[model samples]
Structure formats: structure tokens, C-alpha cells
Target: MYQNYNNNQLCLSIPLEINISSNHVAVAISHFVDSIPDKLIYEKAMTSGRPAYNPAMLLKVILFAYTRQNFSGRKIEAMAQENIPTKWLIGDPDTVPSYRTINRFRSSDQMKRLVEAMFLSFRQLLKAQGLIDDSALFIDGTKLLADANKYTFVWRKASERFEGQLDKKIAGLYQELVQNKVDLAMSDEAPKTDSKTLEKTSEQLTNEIERLDQVIATEPIIPGGSPNKRLRRKFKHDRHLIDSDYLPRKRKYESNNAIFGDRNSFLRLIRMQLLCA
Candidate 1:
């Protein structure tokens, strides 16, 4: 998802005569944009302080950038400024948002809604064009490498940290008990325990228990969420063995191997039949 480039590199520019077509992603996004209910999403923006770019154009540019895996607002802005296809798609070669604004917009709920709407529209269009055969479907999954190392796997760390925290809590409780004993020894009267202090300490212990419970419940024994939920649930049922026997050993080898398998790769392969009318 990240690319490295040397800015100091210079090359001789040569003009070659070759036919190049418009970007397919851009075209598809443009069609989706055109089909959006603009009045619903754009009406509010039109009355704002200064408005120039339409929702369709902005949505198209954002989607195009996303398809290219250029999710960063700064990268998108750079592409808009320098890339011909991006510029053409936006219909504004001159208009480019600052990285800050673009980032804010990208993170907004409105963008999510727009993307969902666009996807639905695109799916409907494809269906109308007889591009989907709903009779048969294939599903599969592959592992995706997290942006972290094997050492970063926190399950073991969490356990160690939890043990240390529990030790500290016990030590604190011991100190409180010692203090109570000292107070009782110094005075003939029975040492009075502060009810509020006891309640607060109890609450802290309860909170720690809740925290541990959450961590245990949500541990990555299996991935959970939409497309992968079924697979994840099945794996969860077998998690104890998977984690103890497979994951640890496999992760150990994988961490040392330079050539991580397709599981670590981002590439996806999907093939479906298009039934044309």
C-alpha cells in the first residue's frame, strides 16, 4: 500500500506516439457519480461559504484514488495535481484541496455514506447490464499480514503485563493492610477504614477485571467482521488448538522468512460469470 520514490532522480523526457485510453476505474467511478442523487448529498454543500467542486466530481476523485490504494489525502492531492487521469476525472485540472481538508472530508461519515451509495448504484448497474449470475457464488479467504511484526503479537505481552499489574495491585493492597495495622497499634480505638477509599479500591479492581475480560474476549484467536465472520466463527470454535499448535509455530517460521506467502500479500483474486441478456 506504500510506495517509495526518489525525488532527485531525473530522466530525459521523450515523446512517443502511442494510443492510450481513459482509465477504466475513473470511467466506472464517473458513471457511479453521475447516477448519485446529487440533490440529497450536495444541496447542503451548495449553500456553504465557498463551493466549487460538485459531490459527483469529488466522489469520483476520492473513489479513483481509493481504487489505486492511494488512501492518504496528501497522496490524492498530489495525484490530482500531477496525474492526467485524476485531473481529467475531477474535471478540474486546477482545483485541488489541501491535504488537511481532504483528510477531514475523507474521514467524515458523509464520505462513507457516499461510498456505500456509489457501490450500491454500481452493483445495480452491473445487474441491469446482465453482469451478475446470482445462481452460483464462490467464497474463500486468505490471510493478510498485519502492519506489525511477530514480536508485536500482544497476546503473550498482555498476559505478562496483566500479571505484573495484578502483582502491583496486590502490593498496594498489602500496603493498605499494613497501614491499617499501624493505625490500630498506635491507637487504643479500632482503626476506622474509610468507606469511600474501600469503595474506590473495589471499583479499581472491578475495572481491571472488566479490562481483562474484554482483552480475553476480543483476542485475535480469529478475525471477526462481515465477509469473514462465518469463517472466523468456525475458526473461533477451533481457536484453542489453532493458537496453541498452529499459529505460534507458523508465525515463528513466517517471521523469519523473507518471502511471506500470498497470505501476507494484498492481491485478491475473484472470478465470476457475466450472464449477458
Candidate 2:
């Protein structure tokens, strides 16, 4: 028999936060997560049974695990058991979430959206506290791996630079069309020459060249007939410019814009060092 042992004994109550250091990363995680409005974490409430594990606590656990470089679900579960700071964040002595539960919550679509929102909120908080300037992000020199394709990374600055050069070239071509007296009926003060504008210009040039060809073929020049040679050469030159320059540039712009698609920046890895710091 166990000496004065009772499995159901109630111990003295103590605040979990007291056991965790004020300056510990886990404490920071707890405070940061708690700072986020509850509406973001609790999209829906359970209909029955004991209340679900607090999403804020789950977030704290996940973030604290990441700080410790414990990415694997099993490792995080074990860490939750053995790590005092992490256990304090959870605060429930009897409840240790299974690895499967932890993995499912992190991998869910809701979590994905929530993480994006959290990042935005985190950055805003940093800005308000004078910890980060909009112009600069001071991350440590630690190399962190990201789960995205390197080839698909599109830099906004590079895209803008290329687009500016393309527009300048297109504007030059438009000036040539004006100088040549080509009647495409476009204005000098028209909106910026985007991919659609370029495509329309290319099509107009191609049709004009075809019309010039038909005129040269069907209307034989009488002794004083309007000269076809000059007309044919002008239209052909414009057609060649559109084909060689405008169309290719338009395609490139379209492809790059498609890849960029509402993202002002590439997939950035948030190093735990930066967050914990």
C-alpha cells in the first residue's frame, strides 16, 4: 500500500504565470497571443461537451515550440510535457494536447488565415511600440527555411523596374506611330500603356499592314495613282516593330503580373530569433 497516497488529492492552487519567468519567450508568446482579439481565434464555438482547448493557449504553445526549434508535433507534445515555460503557457495541469491534435490545428486552413492576420497584427504592434520602422526589418542573421519554391519568388521592386522600362519602350513606339501619321485614333494623353493597350496596338498595326497589302494587290497604280510603295513600307515597318518589340514585352509583363498576384512581397520566413528578441 502507498504511504498516505491518494490519486485524487487536491493540491494547493498556484498561478501558472508565477512559475514562468517574466522575461521568458513563453511569457511573451502568451501576452502576444492574448493581445490578439479573441474573435480572430474563435471563429466558431463548440455545440456540446467540455469547452474546446483555448485557441490562444494552442497558439502560445505552437509559437513557444517554434522558438525552441521544436517543429515536429511529437517533439512539441513532448516539449509541452517537459518544458516548464510551455506548460505554464497551457496552464492546465491535467490537459496535454496530443501530437495529432496539435498537428491538425496548425495545418488547418483556418490556422493558415489566422497566422497571416497574426503577422499583420504583430507588425502593427511593433510599429506602435517603436520596435520596427516601416522602412526596415531588423532580423537576425540566422538562416531559416521556408516552405515555398524559390523560382516562384517575385520581388515587387524588380517587377516595378521591369514594368517601368517596358512602359518607356511602349511609349517610344507610340510616339513613332504618331510621327508616322498612323490613324489608330489613340490619344497622346491616353492612360498608361499597359499590356491590354499594347495588345490592342499590335492588333491595329497587323490589320493596317493587311489593309495596305490588299490595297497594293487589288489597286494597281495608274500613272498618277497614290504611291503604294511608301504606304506598304510604312505599315510593314510598324508591323515588324509591334511583332519584334511590343508583343513580347506585353507577354512578359502579363506573366510577371500574374505571378505577383496581389502579393507586395515574397514568402518571408519569420525567424524565431526575431520574434523572441
- Candidate 2: residue 183 lDDT (0-100): 62
Q: What is the C-alpha lDDT profile of model 2 across 136-202, one tens digit per residue? A: 5557764545534444555887878887887787778788787766665666576447766666776
Indicate the TM-score of model 1.
Answer: 0.42
Mind giving the per-residue lDDT tens digits that candidate 1 earns over 1-277? 7797888889785644322265466776777678777754574655667765565667777888988999888899898898777877866556786777777776878888876776777778888889985787655443344443333322434444554554454345435545433221323243222333333334443444455466666656655544334433433433333334433444443343333333332222233334333
- What would you estimate as the lDDT of candidate 1? 0.57
lDDT score for residue 134 of model 1 = 79
**What 10-residue stretch in candidate 1 is worst by lDDT?**
182-191
What is the total number of backbone clashes in candidate 2? Answer: 0
lDDT at residue 65 of model 2 (Cα atoms): 92
